[model samples]
Target: MKLRPGGFSADRVLRKFLPRSLLGRSLLIVLVPLVLLQGVALLLFYGNHLNELSRRLAGGVAGEAGFMIDEIDRAPDMRSLIIQETDRYFQFTTVFLPNQVLRHLPPPDAPGPVDDDLARALGQEMHRPFNVAWNTAPDFIRINVQMVDGVLSIDVPRKRLYIGTFYLFLIWLIGTAGLLFGISALFLRTQVRGITRLATAAEAFGMGRDPGPIKPEGAIEVRRAATAFNRMQERLRRFLAQRTIMLAGVSHDLRTPLTRLRLSLAMLPEVEPGEMAEMTGDIAEMEQLIATYLSFARGEGSEQAVPTDVAMLLEDVAAAARRAGATIEIGAPEGLTATLRPEAMRRVLTNLIDNARRHAAHVWLSAAIHGRTLRVSIEDDGPGIPTSQRETVFRPFEAASPGGTGLGLAIARDIVGAHGGDIFLFDRPGGGLRVVIELPA
Candidate 1:
């Protein structure tokens, strides 16, 4: 088998950040810039809008103040008329006659302006705009003092525009944050899903299973990775095919000559009985080895999928073993079925049980359902393989007995693997070796 690289797949890399994965991090990177851009846009937009509104406000206030000033100038000698006329056009109007004695100021909540500077400006016949705020409230009064032969002060409440703008900006900031979070989540989810598919496919392929071709979808980088995986899968298939063909040819060629020699040994002289028996045994072992090799080389046939009764198949194999004088037990659920090539599965199970009977005094066969998977186990009552050598024992040419051909386990593994299943040797809980097989249900 080919070695896997040290680093994880792209999908895994993204999964680490968004959903708490890299994709999420990338989305955040893009979203932060967008949020900043929106903030700047809102600032500029509010500034332009407020500047225009401020200009109009200033002009209107000045016009209203100028008219009041003209009326006051006309009635310089009549203080009572000035106050009465001012009241008709202004909501808040107050006039204080020139006094030699200064009076103590009223408390902060008073509606009228109490600024001494504005009072002096009015008396001096000076015209200018000045801001004076109430201590009890956020209200700021803009006083236009006019001293045209007499004291006159007009007050207009300001600060409305700024307060309204504050509330508007607060709403806009909240809305922008929500929008950024939603868009980032959407983009990150899409990227992460594609990466996840690629990772799953890569893992299946690495485990010596033929995972179907990866569809190139999603971002450019993801598509590129899928393309690379497809190429690797194709190369692996070609390599296995070539190896299988080579082994098949060698097995066939070698076995033909062995067959001829075995037949010739039967015709050997009866006087040479000891030599003949020894030669026959050697030839028989060689033939067995050749047969095992060929079986491994010839993988499962290209047969269409069909449903088969697993319970019946196990029963048949068990009966055959019993007839051969092997102590084999069978256990399976009623009406259990599986999608597979029946002949191939039969051959694989037969080889497993046959090998077990040869090594162990008795064998127990059992089947069980595990969620979406079907599990089968063959356990023996003899000494199991060493813990450290379990993996090596499944390899070809690594047999416990001198005359045993290790190809039996290898062939069984290949057949099961082709069906998207696996065979493993484990130490039985009680004792001896246990061969467990897992197949998709």
Candidate 2:
């Protein structure tokens, strides 16, 4: 499929924020909604349930303090008696100051929900103005109520205004979500692993390498895809085998009659030289056409892939071309090795170089490594192919040049494609054709 230029750039931008792999994307699909649900639940619990509970707890503490203040005011002579009784029963300590008055102080910088609730509750219950200090000490809350001539100081323990159940609810919510996400990740990874194996097998088969038996696994859809791939692989192999056999038989049968005709022409006495030359030339062209067809049909034979030094192979091709009176320049790095069918790859390179030599006086060959791919370019100084005809020239029997069988580029492309590589044609920098071959390292 062809993509618009802007489509590719937009996809890249989207990928920057999205996960790149199937497993990660699947995990995101599962976890995002779960996190949002948990967030909403926590918000509701804090807004309604936790807030109401804090207010009630604060009100209870304020009620106890108000009762103590009223008892001390009604019987000022028994202030010590009221203090002793309240301390014994309610866990509060109250002191009566006769001469000094207490001033109101500012609230703390970091006040808790309990502090706000307590302030409101105390404001409604007490008739006189008061000051509430939450940070007077770490373990207690202090409330000072102004009296006509003195002040009433009350100290209450911090635990009286807090609900222990709030913390328990939070722990349960977070711990359960973590456990659920972990389980989901484990399940997702197992399913994704099957797809990974299937992709690897498909790639190896495309490169003409043996991919051992593929067993179906994962979800039903993934299994279906694997089954389809296996069937396609078998059908392609059978078709190629049948074609090769048919071509071999045809080539053998045609050559026998052509050989007898050549012998008959040679034995004829006083044959017209011009007519005889023409007949022989036609016979020679027929033979050359048959040979080219046979070569393309056989697909360079069934050769196993092995590690080969690409630089040395190029050097040998250049040396051979030079001996044939072709000026060829090769630029490649040392010790560049790749797994390949050496004979087939050599044929591909030789065909490209020969085609270049036929049109240009000087040919240039260069290689470079880009990421995980090795790129090799062959350039010539001849007239470059027009963009419209570049793809058409790769078809069998479709030649760009006169008197050519037109199978050179087609055969080269087939061989390169079998090795999971691609060949592209472009205009040379100065004025000719440039062919680029890209192979995975």
Candidate 3:
């Protein structure tokens, strides 16, 4: 993502994390923090809940054990009540009494060892106890105990509280991170939409499309960039206008004197014969040079554009070439319409055809549709331009031929550019040169 001139973009910050696109980067920016926040919140919530649960569990176990002891002391036959209350009140329940003297009143199973720690604490002899597993892993074992002297003992499951708390934190972390990342990506795309538009407009402008002016609406930074680009385009327009005015003045001043000289030389001809003819030829070449400049000076804005039959225009150019003893083929059926400045476009095509006629034995002029564009090509069977000279031929004052004025192709290029079109000169396949002009349909 590119930062605007006057202000920074959020997309720039987003790039640090995502490092790919405005959307991806911005999402990561928002997502990382939100995920961290969610993780912290989950940790706090789960920690508080687990802490309370652990406290309640410890209290309940101690309270139930005390109650059972009191019940046993209250009535000798209340042992069944103790067992029933234990089963009802606690998550894990077991009963024990001294040695084999205590047994399951309902039935008989092998006697189990009482909790050694609980029995030692209660000052009671060994008794059978049944194991119970609760918060601990399935393999975790625990036992409850009752001494013959009515002292009760209990061994709570170990490691279950710690492991449960850790697992809950892990689950909360994963879930919160996933949710936060998804939400962040959705929101960030909305924020980056404006930036994407700005980037696309810049690219179009760079590619020589008159994408018009961007609507300066969005975040402050993006609006400022659009406004600046508008200003720059306005300045560029003024510069081109100024250049055209200067060139027009120069061409007029230079051509008026050249015109007078040509008329004077025509009057003086046949007197000095060969000397006069050589001087007249040089003067004629100079006049042609001046005319070429004038043509270039007359830029695209000087011509009015309208929907014109390109096929007809091409036929006219080819007919003019044929009349000059140039072998030119005109392609396309008549009546193909396109938006163009017919007079200017005609001049461009004529200049290209004239160049080809001068250089080669045969020239081909053709028009065809290329997707949404209208393509006109002039190909010639001549020694083609070198790769290095292809681009140089388009520059003003760089002649492609020894006797040629270079401004013909240059003027054509400028005119095509002004109409939001392009022209390219290249070597045709199997030899010769090809000039292609592309204009929007």
Candidate 4:
């Protein structure tokens, strides 16, 4: 990965903030637009619709107050009657304080656009010194105006300026956004679950375990991927079966000639015992070579993985090698279990041990677990392979030692790869060769 300044990778930073799962990302895809739409809707409705309506209402109230002022100025004697009529008709309360002088007051702090709009409307209509009190009462706004005689105070009902439609609209907007988000989350989870199952099946199959076929589900693309995975599994299984059959036929045909040669060598008359023995050994070697080729080409076919006690498996392979007259030593803990194809794994260990014993008297076999990985080593005192040729030794027909078919390590590597593991060769600490196998625990 490339790093940005301060040793932080740009992709790493993005991953830290980004949702790691498909379901979360898919829900974000739905929710981001929903939230943006809600914001735009609120801005348009409150800014245009609610604002204009509140301004008009404020103007109407300001007009009524101006008319009251005009009537009082026209006939000061009927001021009491005008106040009574205005209070009765407009659902307002009026009071007069005699000989009171009005002072210039800065506009009060406004709770919303209504207060600012109302003050502007009042200035336009009343055309005199005035003050608007917003929080003196919960349901009423107080407006005091300067008159020739004294100050006239009026309380206007707040409901006239506010229809309260915005609150209802806000509630609907939030409720719908939440409902849509919930639906999106639920839908995305189902789609993501199908992909998760497909990935899990693929991993299991890669590890040489049978996960069977998964049912195609969810969206079209997801269902098609599942179907394709199932088909791939079937095709691979058929291909392995066909290869095994063909290999078996080839091995039989090759062995028939070797069998006839062995019989002919046994039936030869007046032949030197040593020559006959040499011929017999050559024929036997050819037969063994054919068997080894077949084993290598067949690989690990149709072997379902299962949990095996690896400690016990190692002990078994070691004991078998000892029975075959090869000295073996082991180091493993009790109950060291791992998922593997036991027979295939045994073949791999046997090949490595046999190879080591061919060139060295003593062989060491050990198994251990490291984190989520299982590691096995076959070490010997044989002359280790050269550094340059270590990798080349794994290729077929490139034997690491004399008289080796070179298929032993190749077959071992094939089986280990099938188990989603790897085999490596290295120089041993005591000046010998060490072959290590690492697998998922």
Top model by lDDT, which number? 4
Q: Candidate 1 residues 127-207, lDDT tens each? A: 542333344234545452425333344445654223366457768877878887788778777877778889888765643
lDDT of 2 by residue, 1-441 (tens): 788766767668878999989999999999999889888998888889988988998999999888888887899888888989997787887777777677768865433478788888999888888888778888888889887778888888878887777788789889988999999999999889889989999898778776766888888988898888888878877887788788889999999999999999999998999989998998999998888888898886467678889999999988988998899898999998887788888889988998999999999998877899878899999998899999998999988789898999999999999889999999998899999999887
CA displacement after TM-score superposition, residue 133 of candidate 3 (Å): 14
How many clashing pairs does model 4 include?
0
Highest TM-score: give the candidate number.
2
Candidate 2: which pairs clash?
none
In model 3, pairs of residues that clash are: 99-127
Provide TM-scores for the models: 0.55, 0.83, 0.54, 0.74
lDDT of each: 0.70, 0.87, 0.69, 0.90
Each candidate's number of clashing pairs is 6, 0, 1, 0
Model 3, span 1-441: residue lDDT tens: 656685777766665546677676677678778867876776676567655665554444445555565566677677777767665665445445445332233221211122223233323322233323332334333444445554233444454223465567678678778876778676666557767777777655543345567777657887888789888867766776788898878878887888788788779735677877887788878878777766776565545567888888988888888998899877886788887788889889888888888989999888888788989999999898888878888888878579877888888888788667899888898889999999877
Q: List the residue pairs that clash in candidate 4.
A: none
Instruction: List the candidate 2 regions with Cα displacement exceeding 4 Å.
Output: 1-16, 93-112, 127-138, 142-154, 254-287, 300-307
Model 4: worst 10 consecutive residues (lDDT sum): 103-112
Candidate 2 local distance difference test against the native: 0.87
Checking candidate 1 for backbone clashes, the offending pairs are 17-20, 17-21, 17-22, 18-21, 18-22, 125-147
Question: Candidate 4: RMSD over Cα atoms?
Answer: 5.1
For lDDT, candidate 2 versus 4, the one ahead is: 4
Off by over 4 Å in 3: 1-24, 40-215, 218-224, 258-287, 297-350, 364-378, 412-427, 435-441
